[model samples]
Target: MSKIMSAPTLHHFSSLFTLFIVLLHHSNADVGTASRYSPPYLPSGCYGTEATQFPSSNLFAAAGDGIWDNGAACGRQYLVRCISAEQPRTCIPDQSIQIKIVDYAATAVSPASAGGTTMVLSDKAFGTIANMSATLINIELQQV
Candidate 1:
């Protein structure tokens, strides 16, 4: 009996192990639907005209009822990844964006996506994880 694996066998085994790790890495998070909203993202329910409220990276989001926590959610940062969507291949591979919660989706002065979204990402934040054409995407949300 051979105790050592052949080169090809070892490569295959390593690939499988890597795949398992990638899958496991993304699984530890809350599953939710994320929609996008455009600019003029001011008069936020939390900040209310504070210039410093919005991040320069443009990665920011508004909390839906799921995480709103009655205004407690404000200013919380989250790591979000596009997991799935109505159309296939919408999620950008190996991509995730960190977003700060600047407002509440229901009460934001800016126009947001249709109701019932778990998070309303800013336009730039939404585009980072998924195609712009996708109006909404399934997201893996994790507070960091």
Candidate 2:
């Protein structure tokens, strides 16, 4: 006589098989597209002294030069292009500035404004160029 399987054993096997198939389906569903998440804050080439300055500091630091007077004003209009090292082809903005690039921090942390990019400026530079009181400035970077 052929051996027969018990009902309980058959039910257990069926349950295990169903679980395995469900797991397989779930794993397969995750393939293809990436999960949705917040887009990165794109870095730009046109950084501003307003975006990079700290209020408490006495001077602004240029990325390429030495420290500058915290109260100095730009003698003429200047332009810079903002580009991201992470995304070289992606240009954030294109524009010109009359203000000089001065010494300032590239990033800041505060209780009110926990995290953001930093740009330092002299009081005069800030007043002459932008109405922003926040440490960061929205600037456009143009290719020279």
Q: Quick one: best TM-score, which candidate?
A: 1
Misplaced by over 4 Å in model 1 are 1-28
- Per-residue lDDT of 23-142 in model 1, one digit per residue for the tens? 888555899999999978888988999989999999999999999999999999999999999999999999999999999999988777667899999999999999999888999999
lDDT of 2 by residue, 15-79 (tens): 99999998887321111100011112113123333444322332222221122234242221234
Residue 82 in candidate 1, Cα distance off native in Å? 0.3
Report the lDDT of model 1 for residue 96: 93
Global Cα lDDT for candidate 1: 0.92
Question: Which sections of candidate 2 miss by over 4 Å?
Answer: 1-61, 64-96, 102-118
Residue 101 C-alpha lDDT in model 1: 98
Superposed Cα deviation of residue 23, candidate 2 (Å): 48
